[model samples]
Target: MSGTGFWTPVFDIEKRGDGSILMRQNDPLTDHRPTLADALDHWAETAPDRPFLARRAPGGGDWRRISYGAARAAARAMGASLLTLGLGPDRPLLILSENSLEHALLGLACTCVGIPFAPVSPAYSLVSKDHRKLREIARTLRPGAVNADDPEAFAPALAALAARGRHVISNEDGPGRIGLETLRGGDPAGAEEARAGVGPETIVKYLFTSGSTGAPKAVINTHSMICANQAMVRDCYRFVAERPPVVLDWAPWNHTAGGNKVFYLVMTNGGTFYIDDGRPVSGRFDETLRNLREIACTWYFNVPLGYDLLVEALEGEPALAEMFFRDLGMMFYAGAGMSQITWDRLRAVARRTAGREVLLATGLGATETAPFALACTEVQERAGNVGVPARGLTLKLVPQGGKLEARLKGPTITPGYKGDPAKTAEAFDEEGFYKLGDALRPADPEDFTKGFFFDGRMAENFKLTSGTWVPVGAVRAALVDAMGGLVRDAVIVGENAPELGALLILSEAGAAMAPEAREAALAERLAAAARAATGSASRVRRALVLTEPPSFERGEVTEKGSLNQRQMRGNNAEAIMTLYDGGPGVLTF
Candidate 1:
């Protein structure tokens, strides 16, 4: 299938009399498998030897492949073992590690036999000084078993959790750990019997939200939710059915974007997934570049900053660019907005390398939605048009604070967060639609088919002393863009204040400059941005260079690098006060 043929854009929109809008895809969603295990069974039988998953060798040589048949066999054995260890829906397994073969197999095993497993973010264990979030998750889950790929590396976190009688699984044998081989030594007949009990309503996994706002809530993921989500994905990106998707992804599986969406996308389609060990950061991104040079993904995904770095690499290296665009069906970005600069550069690079423009798209969904509700496949000239609602979803846009608050009702939407009935009650509306807490603006007010742009987060936006509302998401994006690559991100603060101020997180370029030069450059850029703004609500009058990066422990940033504007503002209340007080180091426009 050609890149342009990936999606056929069609939407059905209805404007209600109550100043609300409803939208959905015209095409109805097709039947999907009852469970993801069903898909695994089918693929293992049909494409036994085909590579379903691959990862780089220990020291990074060639890709080590796991065939569908091998995966199914491992799942059965491991599933039986988990059952033997008294793990089930109530006392689930908790994974604490980066993406690895062991992690994938363990997750698959849990899903196959209806044992709900939670892949907690490794940062909570490794990066945090106190492992506070990890302990919190442990308390919430009360997991029967815990798997840490390297027992030695995660020993401190494991100690913090104080796993006394819990089953400890690891890649290598340790003092009190069960090795992967031991898990794979169980009887397959037991797993078969357990699999018979698994159905659509069976809980598959628990994907925890980044606890930026508060303690991470375990979003309940069921077999039905994931299978239906993959069905929606296949319906939209029809090319996946034509040619099984070949994806190389690095997004952590703890988030729904990766664990449910991308992970199941490959499994349902019988596609190959190359687990890229590289990340988008300075030291780790080179591994991604090296992987891209060898593997050409049919469908690609990255955050905006990842694309920014990738475009730079692609522009400078022709071979890398060619390899990247080859066999590429589409590119996707989420978690944050892509700057127009990065968008244009990516399109240009693709056109130059592949002789055509590939589909560069963004979408709006959340952990509760199985993260595949509304996707934009249209070749947008600019960024932030999150297309229309997918089939099997009813998108409700309720007017609130001069913006449309996006809500969704679908099979893909999670039933509720686990172990928190109060939070779940607050999540849905009277009509049972999950409120996204995000506001959207129609790309064209007269035509709903033109798609919707992410206006801002309703929770993030605040009013100034002048009574004008400031859209923090939009303002922060504009400020980062206006800084001309000098600022990576910003926390906008001006709730009930005379004007807006920002705590700017510097980009690599900005950080490398001398203190005086950096201050001057930021001041000039801030002046330019203020002059360009049409109102006090949008203008940022002052800013302070945030020398310290957002801390994961502090809930100032997510694993995907999205800033918690509310948390940051509260964490740096003194700094924000200084900006308003015209203290030293405050750069005024």
Candidate 2:
């Protein structure tokens, strides 16, 4: 446990000696309830007064908390109202805003009545210029109702999808919109009967994929998948169930980690969740800092970008660091691999502030696996170690191409994508394992107990003009880390080209520097990084700074902020051409 009162590492691996390997935790899984509503019911009865969910007031005024009992009462009323609207399995509810108190309650209301709900990325409805993806999603889901926090904000999207024969719900009613208060004022006569009907197989929600490649597919999330996943998380963490968890989260609920994993993690454990308005992006992280100063989280989670910004904040302010570690149990990162430098900085800050090292860890999973399949409970120094599979899950490493492809099979695994049976069939192998399209490499060949590292996404790798394959994940990580704080994230270019290139999104630190200084610093770092590389595949010879952030509407980035390399390259064809054509801003090795 690294003397930090976090998890203790205990991993085991069984090699079949054929071409496959299996890895899992040594501990058994805890008994899980059939549905998420059951967990809510249990906690509502036991810890009625505990704060279950909270969000900042409008304009970030103050925090508003909802007790478990209050939440259940509101959800029952809302669920009954939804039933009156003719919403069922076929006509699901769709939420189009960021996380909020109403969002949580309404999501629970749908699940309580065995009515499915889908939360799509807010960017699709709000940020997209043409509303292309939003229209496509509306056509695909055919939602019976749509909820948004602010009607004025999503007015365009709501009007565009109005012809789908659905009700538009808003906290504040506008023209042709239903008010939230109306739903809360409904009778709870059918709530108990509806709750009783929910079981493990009941479809609770649909979590859409990031759609980094093509059109996003809705991943079916059942009651069993969420409950079993929470069980795996509870068994792995071991300390979460002991006390009420307090989390300050900024990740959007449209994705799995924030939606099912973190939200349910807090709900199942009788925890208090503070929805952070501050994202990890520039000019918004200050909101996160404000929240952290007030709330001492028991468990913390952030992306590598958030941690990079936070490490600096923690280092500069001792009082803030003290407040942060006051009740922190463990620090976790996800959505992408964290750098070893960032990992070291985090541990050092923990040791400095708390007088002992805190457990810094990460895990591996996908939207299809309920997103909590594999976890690293141990304390390690290296980055990208995703540890072993969870207690109730199976990890199969089948040799494919030159890497071991990861496959999963468990109660938490999704049955199939919504409305896509053929695509679902192609997602799994003959043995009924969900083929995760990701590759893994053993950290220690002889001792699998050391865990495994994420090799690269099989679908993301590409061949150079020399016929040599490039592992984009590893190369991107190395390049991003090597550029120091200059690059936030990068999309590897030069697929089928002579040498590798990069389209870099500058970090806040990089953007803050003087123009000339920024370019010089970036160019020097790129040259040094390229000079240190041993092969053409690893070395980046040309680079271009991406001035615009990745467009969610264009599918250049996922809602979780992961880059889609192919999409980025294809979308920025002109930039790549300019780089090779000796453009003015191009940096060369």
Off by over 4 Å in 2: 1-18, 25-28
lDDT of 2 by residue, 1-589 (tens): 2233434546567788777987666766668888888888998999999998888888989899999999999999999999888888899999998888888888989988989999988888888777776777777788999998898899898887887469888886668887889899889887778878889999999988866565678999999999999988887787898888999998888889999899999998889999999998779999999999999999999998889889989999999999999988889898787766788888999999999767788889999999998777777877788887888787889987778999998889999988788899999999899999888887888877667888888988888999888888889999998988788899898887999999899887888999899999999999999999989889999999988888877778776677888888899999999888879899999
TM-score of each: 0.98, 0.96
Model 2, global lDDT: 0.87
Give each model's clash number. Answer: 0, 0
Q: TM-score for candidate 1, please give it.
A: 0.98
CA RMSD of all predictions: 1.5, 1.9
Clashing pairs in 2: none
